[model samples]
Target: MDTEQQSQTKSEFEREPVPKSALLGFKSFIGMYAGEHCAGTELMLGPLFVAAGVSAFDLIIGLLLGNALAVLSWMFMCAPIATRSRLTLYYQLEKICGRKLVILYNLANGVMFCFLAGAMVTVSATALGVWFRFKMPGLNDLYPNSVGWVVAVAVAGGLIAIVAAYGYQTVAKFANIAAPWMVLVFLVFGFVGLRQFIEATGTEIGSLSDVWHLAKTQIWKGGPPQEGQVKFTFWHVTFFAWFCNMAMHIGMSDLSVFRFARKSWYGVASGAGMYVGHFMAWISASILYAYQLHLNPADTDVLPGPLAYRAAGLVGLLCVIIAGWTTANPTIYRAGLAFQALSPKSSRFKVTLITGAIATIAGMFPAIAMKLLGFVALYGLVLMPMGAVIFVDFWLIRKFGMQSYYAELSGKTFNWAAGLAWFVTLAIAWVLVKFAGVQIFFVSLPGWFVAAILYIVLSKFYQKKLRPDAVQ
Candidate 1:
């Protein structure tokens, strides 16, 4: 090559650092979504839907519509931005929101991600408890059930944390390898569960109506939530389906993942996760739970390990264990990325290890995973505003005659407008939830709108005072 061409190539490589690009094709995401979404937590979340009194129609229809919305959000909103920027969410946020704002955001994002992973760890450990013959907790049980349970959780958490610390490539590879097996097991579990239910109830289904009748009567019966559980209605199911992954979709966290897509159409790949993991797996798990409840109406433990073991023997148990790890591995990797952004001096590997340690501790408390439905809603709400800021700033700011990435351009230590917009919007949303008694599930959408509007207004005013040179 000519000297000029070589110089240009070297400069390009230096400016844009290259990380491993082991994730290729739609299959990687297919495995990831299926493996990550059809997880041990599904065993918990699906039962919670039943406990929340979601009717058959609402759960089925709402998931279809809501998951479609999530897919669209990724396609139109997140992927375009990600492919254009090709940076992790933290780095992108740092450029626009500045170091001070991103530090706070990263801390919150990392903690929430860790806690979420910890919950997955908790889910897997419950399965291990069955093999160890230790006492396990019920749906209402929040604290650790036994010393053996705690030890199992610790061991599982440590293994998952180590894998996560190795970084994103390993996490994706692990998911891709485990996903197909897990998906098959979940499907088999569903079929076996339905057969068991049919035998017990002596019901025969030959039509759609029959399935619906059976689902309402024997599966997801619309009843009052169990003790300490919140009631759910049609709206609750709809909103929960939409916002459960609010961080990834509405919050734009998937900007990191989608950034690598060869085309925006790759966003459609998310459907693999939503339908298989969230929809089919969720329903399958609920079937298992319903059967469990039918066998012993008084039993309320929603542990996936025991549920799967009862349904499909050792294979089911192994599915839960591997599925939980597959999900938690990526989650912990994302958490590590968030934390690593806080200290640029720290190696990503070391920071990830430390982040995993935090996740392991959080896993020790089953409350996070056990109360996952509510916790997921809250976690999504917390991180979503910054996502809104990124979204509005990237697409809308230039149209409004304001500079994008103003923090980097102006050399500002902190961008008050971005920081204040996130906090103020969240504060208002919190007031609506706590003081006005609004449902938590509905807060994220409105909060996103509030953040978007506030950022535009704040950016206009904040930029007006800058010197002529700073405007560039």
Candidate 2:
């Protein structure tokens, strides 16, 4: 089972590839990607689109194009490489970039995963907060507001972490149980909110065009930017949708997920997420927020709990809690794997438990969850260059007369070419954001190309220098 944690006795595949006996079916991937994508973060991200003041046409059209691109990237770029190589991103990177470089990568990957898992925990806490009546963070909140908020987060995060520490089987079972019900709740949110909108506005909405008109004028009105938010356009929506999962697909992080697949075509399974979670769930959640704004324009808080409660009542509330757990559980498990990569001799349970603690502490603060829009963009950008490196090493290095895995072949502790590619590409991305007036959402597209080209070019020079007799 792909979801079950591999046996503890299994090593890092230092000897052979993942056996064919271990490969999983397409349905496994469909469930996994859908569960991961249509999860707690969707609750956070869907409302944010409305906050950005996106138009009906732009938001709708952009998501269509962007999600298609994400699905294609998964099928063509991520899956083939993962299935062919049959190595985890960590093991593969260690081979190409060497142990010293991979250590730094693992540390960064671990922290990023923890913070992301923490955000999901925060989402779960909001459901509890609804019952406890604890102070929840508003849109602009940067810190934990009350002791009730703190305790809610700690308790929520602790439980999520404990489940993750038990390994992938526990995480998988939890997600499978929750995924179907949560997805149903998301759909109910859309329909209930839509009915309310028609009733509230007294509009004669009877056809698709009526819904389209409502989408433009009443819901996503293409208005001026909200206070402390950016105005989103077609390009912004398209790019953000595509790049939101940049680390997982374009950056090869899902190499971990897809490595267990029976066939590369299983990559198409991500469509379950792009359409279900990113499309329907996002639009539905937006309807809930739009309705809230209609009722009380002053209540501009992007809290998912209140929004969901208004739509499906109690079922929605319970769904939010379970959705957040299923989402965070796998992420925490992945983070645990990253931490375990750093100390191969350590037990995964201990490292994962400790990683979960870090996430719980992070959940106490509202900044990570409240600022999720920017944080997700930043997370994808930071991790993307390594993915580009993986791509280039897999396909282009040997064609360029450069030896792949030069660091491993030569017994070096670090590969400067890979390091330089990572650093230089990030520098270029930073320059684009800081000086070129490029938004974070659009920066990774060009940044990916930069990392790919730089890795190939640098490998030629860096490797040749290491082997004086080698030709470029």
Candidate 3:
């Protein structure tokens, strides 16, 4: 190929506008979701269910019902909008919410994305520490346990950031490559852990009741949370499963990913992630934890690196490292885009590097990963409001006889309706959590509805006053 042709091909592959042809078949999404969800972090998140004292029915049935709702939301709500607009969430927000509002959204979105990526960095570093025999943190341990852990995290973070800096194509390619192997590893971890559990208990698998009894007595026994941990009930598990990725699904952040899909059905592919990563992988990882508890009941520290290394040896260790990268890469890329929107002139690659650096720094602090449950819930609540605004603006605005993308059309720098809706919804959700004693998991759903209602009301009022002729 000529120089120009080579450059075009490289650009096409790198930023690839995701052709309608490549928008996706169901299989592509299935693979992507399965791989993306069944990652190393599952090792951490799954065990937390055990810590939270979920009963067998609650853990199994709740995840099934909750994850199904999440998938349906993506298909019915998120994907249709994405297919129609074919724009990144950031760009879409710019049109509806305006540049000023988007800048604030991007900051919040970018910072949250960075913290999430940092947790993945922590996951991969755990594997590195295992390989090098570095000291790892315990469950309650918040600070770095050793210098070796720090260096491992730095090296792993640097590598993940570099992959992310290359942009979306690289992140997607890496995910595609690593996802299959990671899924197998998660499967192996589950199977091996189950065998170990069966052997430890000397229980014969004769009937469903036997399994139920074992699960209740042995596995996810409903009990008080560990010290320094909040108690979790069935509602907590149900809502957490539903809104853990509230920003992506309900908040419409995945518009960037789903915009490439040829049809909305591709949103159904998220079911793979929900079931494989969140459901299956979680159960598997919890099995690992149950085994660990059986072996050492007093041990509170749960690290994926050591856990995997013990189960599948070198292969398991590698899975931990690469699995963490696969998950973090796209996250950092998304974060980079958020930051880049702040300064459209700045190079996305450079901004991504800076974002990666921030993530690396955050990764050094184990507390973020250690508190993954609460952190994930909080992040979703914070970002879900803007998603609600986008949803309402795209689908509901026309019905109200108001213009969609009002900011772009009116040439407004800030859309007070979008801004107030987002902030006010979050403030109300915060109040619910603090004063009303509502569980954090359930807050986002109500918060999203509040934001939607607020956006429509505020938009109608603001537009009527500002552009009276524009309102029907």
| Full-model lDDT for every candidate | 0.81, 0.85, 0.82
Measured against the true structure, the TM-scores of the candidates, in listed sequence, are 0.90, 0.93, 0.90
Ranking by TM-score: 2, 3, 1
Model 3 scores worst on lDDT over the 10 consecutive residues at 1-10
Give the alpha carbon lDDT tens digit for every residue of 327-364 in model 1: 88878887887787778789888887887788888888
Error of 3 at 424 (Å): 0.9
| Model 3, position 76: C-alpha lDDT score | 88
Worst 10 residues of 1 by lDDT: 1-10
Candidate 2 similarity to native, TM-score = 0.93
Cα lDDT over the full model 2: 0.85
Measured on C-alpha atoms, candidate 3 has an lDDT of 0.82
For candidate 1, the lDDT comes to 0.81
Best of the two (1, 2) by TM-score: 2
- Model 3 / residue 160 / CA error / Å: 2.6
For residues 395-454, write the lDDT of model 3, one tens digit per residue. Answer: 898899888988877778799999999889989988998999987888888888899999
**Best-fitting candidate, measured by TM-score?**
2
RMSD of 3: 3.8
What's every prediction's RMSD, in angstroms? Answer: 4.6, 2.7, 3.8
